[model samples]
Target: MRWVFLVLIVLNALYFVWEQQQPSVHVQQLPSVLNPAGVANIEVANATNSQTKTLDSVQAKINLTLLLGGFSDPALIDSLSQRLLSLDIDVKEVVVEEVDGVDYWVYMPPLVSRSVAVRQLKELKARQIQAYLINQGDMQNGISLSMLDTMDMAKDLVQKLANLGYTAEIKEVERKQKTYWLAVNSRSERLIDESLMTELTSDFPLMRYRQEMPQ
Candidate 1:
């Protein structure tokens, strides 16, 4: 019985040795294009690139709006409108803005009426005072000293009148206004009116052209 038990133990030990000698089972790992986070990052990068390209395209494109000269002359503006129409440009309306300015006058006191103003101008001319009648507006009758920009020039004219033994007051006339600009937005930038603009520039020597964003 002891021999039998010894034989059984020897067999179990041999079986354990055989099991240890056997090859380990290997798991087959499939190749993947991207991991979970890697896949998300790649998708995000692709989306960002597409959005950037779209924004670049929009930024590169242009929609033009033009601003032209500001003129005080109605006749000149009317002429410009007609000329622009001739060029097939859809001209916008004239933007009339009244600016405060001084119209210096070399007239005697109490320029009560238009006749008085005219008579005053004549009297000043008779004295050889180089002056003209301010016509068409508020100072219509007053003898125009000079349409000077600075007060120094106006004072100089007043001094000259004083030399001629006459008093001329510098009137702060706010009625006289200036500048007419043509603002237009081209419906399509692909068809730019370069020739028309050139023609306009040629016509008005003082005309200013400015390009801005679409209105």
Candidate 2:
């Protein structure tokens, strides 16, 4: 009777150990993808071929080029790079170049245009569209300002130039280091007077002015 009881206790202990070693039935949680409402369900299967299968599907990598503009803060670059790396996507290469008067960071990924780059940039909490001017010669002869306070001020400056029949165009508006740079266009001969420029500047203290001369 004593031997039978000992044998039963040993069998129960072995059964408990085997149960602990079995695969868990509880599902493993995964990180959320692009969509918040969607949840992914994973199923594992053993195959005769001993190849490892990943839980998440590999997405097509995007190619993007980042233009940093006049903003030359090293902290900004590191922050941006780290944020990009944190995403599920892979960064191929980041090239820093200075073309004409502006600083640029060119990223070569599998992405097509700046719009796509901006979308990815939005994920990192920076949402601004940056453009590279191809013709550097056009930007040579000018005094450029560095920041703008409001869109209304930008519109006002453009309107004032238009009123003078100078045909000014606002190419782009960018904010850098708490200042705004407004890219403007007008005929090369029609020079902006100091008084008018001063008026525009006073009204929009934060505005930086730059001319994008016609090519």
Highest lDDT, which number? 1
Cα deviation at 191, candidate 1, in Å, is 5.5
Distance (Å) between predicted and true CA of 83, model 1?
Answer: 1.4
Model 1 is weakest, by summed lDDT over 10 consecutive residues, at: 183-192
Write candidate 2's Cα lDDT for 1-215 as tens digits: 99999999999999999999999899888875654433222122344122343322221111112122122444444443343345322332222333333222222232344465444444323322232222224442221222235556656655654564423334443323432122222221123456645754565443333323222
lDDT of 2: 0.38
lDDT of 1 at 25: 100
Q: What TM value does model 1 have?
A: 0.40
Q: CA lDDT of 152 in candidate 2?
A: 63
Count of residue pairs whose backbone atoms collide, per candidate: 5, 16
Q: Against the hidden reference, what TM-scores do the models get?
A: 0.40, 0.21
- Give stretches of model 1 more than 4 Å off: 1-61, 72-74, 94-179, 188-193
After TM-score superposition, what is the CA distance of residue 5 in candidate 2 from its true location, in Å?
94
